[model samples]
Structure formats: structure tokens, C-alpha cells
Target: MRTIAEIKESIEADFMRNETAAKLYGFTSGDSFAAFFGKLSVESVLFYLFAVAAWTLENMFESFRSEVNASIDKMKPHRPKWYRDMVLAYMKDRTLIPDTDEYDTADMTDEEITAARVVKHAVADESDDASLLTIKVAGEQGGRRCPLDAQTESQLKAYIAEIKDAGVRTALVNIAPDRFNCELDIYFDPMLLASAVESTCREAIQNYIENLPFNGEYTNMALVDQLQKIDGVRIPELRSATTVAAGESVVTAIDARCVPAAGYFEMGDVKLNMKVYNG
Candidate 1:
């Protein structure tokens, strides 16, 4: 991290050392000295020297930085939690939707890939021969939280297969959809006219609950706070916030937190059943 002035000073000092060496060898011509050492003071020549020295220093610093980073990374734990999260992040953008070509992603816009998410689960079991590792991946996309089609799922499975350890007797890749429907009962003020309610309230609430940070537990307090902020809504209460599979039975009076069994949270419709009351 030497400053420009420091590096320039060092380069100038080097030029002076070479000038002194020339004088010691009887090569000094007071009139021609300007032709030799004067070149070091010339703006263009000085700039060139500074540039080369700075570039060499920068390259050396980069190599040292990379080595230090590598050592730090190696010293860090390689436990499953860290590895799983790393795999999940690596697969997010690397994954593809059904029937989409690999090159198509480069041409595709950001909006097209905004909803993509990757969830991973590792299971170890002993079989007849040796221990086996089974990695399950769930890829979700779009508003409805649909799963990747067969083709894309296969491609994603192949993409992650390279991370398997050699000691594993067998490594299997499991892929599926992670769509979860969230049912909620939100109470509102009766004085507020129904017509005044925003048509996008359902969408808003859906986005709020859905967009809760990945691997985060959904809290009823957060959801209620967001719902209460809506127009024509007051004293919002989540009577029920049950997480269920798509088309599955919605358990009433269950835990308000939508805790994911796996890492991904494929949010479904808000299913807000609004009740109006004076309280």
C-alpha cells in the first residue's frame, strides 16, 4: 500500500544510484549528464518509470493478497453448514429453468432471473458397501413458486455433482419444488371502508412474507407490522399463519412462524382472510 509519492521517490533514488555508479566508472560528462540522468526527471520518462514500478508492485501485492486469502479460507472450518450455504449461493445463478440453453442466460435480462433460488440438504446413510451421501436440491422460480422442469433439474443436478467427495461410496442428487402456501387471518378496522383498501394489499403482504431473508424464520410480529401499515387496515393481527404445501391442508391455529424444513421458502398466495371489527 505504498503511496505514489513514496514509490516515485524510490524510483528517483534508484536513478540517482545508477548516475553515481556511472560517475565512479569515469562515464560522467557534466554537460551530457543531463542527457542521461535528466531523462529520469522528464515528465514522460518519470511517468513511464513510475507506471512500471507501480504495476510491478501492484502485481506482487495481488499475489500476496491471494495467498493470504487462501490461507485464511483454509484455516476456516469446512463444516456442513458453511459448505451447504456456499453450494446454495454457487448454484443460484448457475442453475437454469427448464429447456433454457446455457448461453441463453447471458442474453437473458436480470428480471428474468430475479426469482431464482437454490436450496440444499445433505443426508448421510450407511448402505451395504459403505456410507453414502445424498444431496437434495430444490429450485424455485416465478410468482407461483413452480419447480424446475425435468430437463433443467437434471442439468442442475449435474452441475452440483462435481462437489462430491471421493470418500463417499455413492452420491445422489435429489431435486424438487419447495412451494409453501401461507394462510393468514388479518383483522382490520371496521370503520375503514372496504373500497378504500388497496387491491395490491394481498400482493404486498405476499411479497413481504415471501421476501423475508433466505434461511430466516418468519415471525408473526414482522408480518403483523407490515399488514398494519397498509391503507384501510388497523390493529392487524395474525390469528393463523400456517405453512403448508401447495393444495395441502392449511392447519389453523398452528405456529405463526413459517419455518422452512429445508433452506428455501417458496412463498405462495397470502390467503389473507380479513375480518372487520370495531376493536
Candidate 2:
């Protein structure tokens, strides 16, 4: 990663340190040689040559390093992130050539299957069963994450089975977003109308929930902090927060932080109790 200028400077320093070369070139000191190299005349052949050599060497070194790193990555065993990436890269209706484990790319273009893939967001984690991976996936619909349709889910499951490593099992979780409900107590500036403040605060809450990373943790303190940043809000308190996992009806309280079981969450029932701030 050394810049061309740095490499050139290093080469000049090494050349100047050689007393024999300096004496042969009739240069008495390091400053004299540096002055000659710093000139822009056509006679400064060594200076330009060193610059060219350094640039070429730096590029070669970088290319070699990249090739080595790529080789190492290929040799590494499959991990959680790799599984997530594979799931996202899955193309529907693609036939895997038997024993090769690679898709039949003959007469097929990438654009053909791009629209067939329904899974847009994915997260992979280890399951309770040994050698088993749990992958949660969701598709985008109207700018929101949603579960894949029955047909698409079945196609994805079959694809995973074919490409997964031997003896490794994968559990696909394609479900609706978990439901988030909360009640907040907000004391706001009287100058701003209650309705306006309430509207802005509700937007902030919705944004915070929707923007969380796939399977990201949700914390009560973080939500309160987000509300406190809004204008015209003096105090923000989270009265209660609960979530119902997708496909389940029981509500569970979030003590500190909770990760959505379905890989993401949506706003369910939010109640903002806006009150005027009295000093």
C-alpha cells in the first residue's frame, strides 16, 4: 500500500546513503544529491527512472497480495457470513449440474434469474442441532421486508439443500416481521402543537425500527435516546415495550435488548402520550 511518492523517497534515501556512489557522482553531501534529484531538467534521468521503477513495483506488489489473499479466502471453510451470502445469491429455477454443484450457466444470462430471487435480506446463525444452520430471509415488498410466498420458499429450500456442504443441514425461516408495540410518555415544548410533535415522534420511532439491520438487536434505551433527539421534546420516557414473534400470539417484554425472531420487526401499536413541559 505504499504510495509512489513514499517509495520514491525511500529509494532516494538508500541511494544517497551509499558514500561510494555519492563520491563517484561528484556529490559531496546528501543535500547536494537531493538538490540534483529535485530538479526538473532533462538531465535528471535517474530521478525519473526511480519514479517509474517505484510505480511499477508497487503495482506488482499490490496485485500479488490480492491474489494471495483471494486464494486464502477460497481455502477457508464455510462460515455463517458465507451461508448468508450464498442464500442471497440463490437464483430461482436454476438447475445445478449433478456432481458439479455449479449452476448450468450455458445459454443463461444473470438477468434472466435476477427477478426470480425473492429473498433480499438474510441472516444466518447456528441452530441447536449440531452441524445445522438457521437462515432467516425476507423479500422486499412496497419497500418493506416480507416473507416469501409459499412457492418461492419451497424453491429456495430446495436450492439450499443442493448447494449446502455434505452432512450439513439448513433450516430456512421465511416469515413476516415481528410485531412491535409500545407506549411512550413525552413532555414537549408548548410552542409546538401536540399533534405536530406527536407526528414527528411517531415517525422517528418507525424509522428506528424499520432501519435496524437484519436480526439486529432492539433496546429500550436506544429508542428513548432517539426520541430525545427530536425537537420540541423535553423528556421522553418509554412506558412499556413488547413484541410478538411472527406466527406467535404471546407477547414478550423487552428487558434490555431483543433480537427479532423473524430477522426484522414492524410497528404494531404505538401510543404517544404527549404532555406540555412545565418548568
lDDT of each: 0.53, 0.85
Model 2: how far residue 22 lies from native, Å: 1.8
Candidate 1 residue lDDT tens string, 1-279:
666666765655454457665576455433333345545556437656776779688879989999998788666633445435544543444644554322236765766554343443332334454454344444544533334567656655565454444344434344332355555555566776554553545766667755654445677777767777786776565555555543446543346565443334555545666667565
The alpha-carbon root-mean-square deviation between model 1 and the true structure, to one decimal in Å, is 9.9
What is the per-residue lDDT of model 2 for residues 1-279, given as tens digits with 9 covering 90 to 100? 776667667767777777887888777546544576545654345666777787898889889999998788666667788889888878777767787446666676667766755678999999655677899999998988899989889988888887777677788999889999999999999999999999999999999998899999999999999999999999998999999998898999989789999999999999999999996
TM-score of 1: 0.52
RMSD of 2: 3.8
User: C-alpha displacement of 108 in model 2, angstroms?
Assistant: 6.6
Residue 25 of candidate 1: its Cα lDDT? Answer: 42
Q: How much lDDT does candidate 2 score? A: 0.85
Residue range with the least summed lDDT across 10 consecutive positions in model 1 = 117-126
